[model samples]
Target: MRDLRARFRAAYGASGWHLLLLVGCFAVAAWVALRLAGEATAGRMLLWFVGAVVAHDLVLFPMYAAADWALRTAVRERRARPASGPSLLNHLRVPALAAALLFLVYLPGILRQGRETYLAATGQDQQPFLARWLLASGALFLASGIRYAFRRWRARRG
Candidate 1:
């Protein structure tokens, strides 16, 4: 059994489950595509998809890549010379990512882009989105900071 498993792994370059999961994901994507194709708004959806890809590739990717590089450089410079403990990069990255994702998802509401539609759909004003997003971002950063401080304290105690 071990030999057969080893042979399978060697041939596949990963566990059989990986291939199964990959196929499953592709099947789900295909299902979504078929469903989208049946919709009257398929052209709009396709346009949005292409626009998102182009925006991410041409604008967002470069901006974030530069920001990440700058952040790493800044963190590396500020950190202790001996890289003995956990790095602060990931702690910063996680909160930033969460905040950015929240901002993006709530962007229309935050910007008050479609006040009438939003009001009609949810019967709520878009006035709170910006404040809520800010509060959430602050909470995420505060939580990350607390966790980092706790880890550092524990490391020092040990």
Candidate 2:
């Protein structure tokens, strides 16, 4: 395995050829997937892929990044307390991202020709993913609440 890896590294030299090969592999894989799942299904996959990429770049990442940066910056400051209060809003970094990503995955189908892949993956004719997203959001909030409650209880008991 090591010898083969070393030979491959020497030959490929990590260049455009490698990227071309990767794209070729993906093309073959996509073809196979379309064959197995049907061309209609493959077309849907393309739409979902585009929607997911757009959302991950535009929406979900920005929220998570901003919250993470804000938290880190708050900690770095010499101020006795962060200017932002220690409130539920300040700690919603993970939940907000989850909610946003969930929403984005569902949004591509809104008032437009819905992506087949999104519908297939979500198992709903319309807006089924939203129900699941809501359930997940509720779960995230419940878990957060339980953790906070437990910590408070522990502090009181001790």
List the global CA lDDT of all models. 0.86, 0.65
Off by over 4 Å in 1: 1-47, 77-82
lDDT string for model 2 (27-108, tens) is 9987877685755577677778788898779976887788777765665443323443334443455565676666666665
Per-residue accuracy of model 1 over 12-88 as CA lDDT, tens digit each: 99998999999999999889889889899998988998899999999889988898888888787546233555558
Q: After superposition, how far is residue 58 of candidate 1 from its true place, in Å?
A: 1.2
lDDT of 1 at 111: 85
TM-score between candidate 2 and the true structure:
0.39
Candidate 1 TM-score, true structure as reference? 0.66
User: Which one is best on lDDT?
Assistant: 1
TM-score of each: 0.66, 0.39
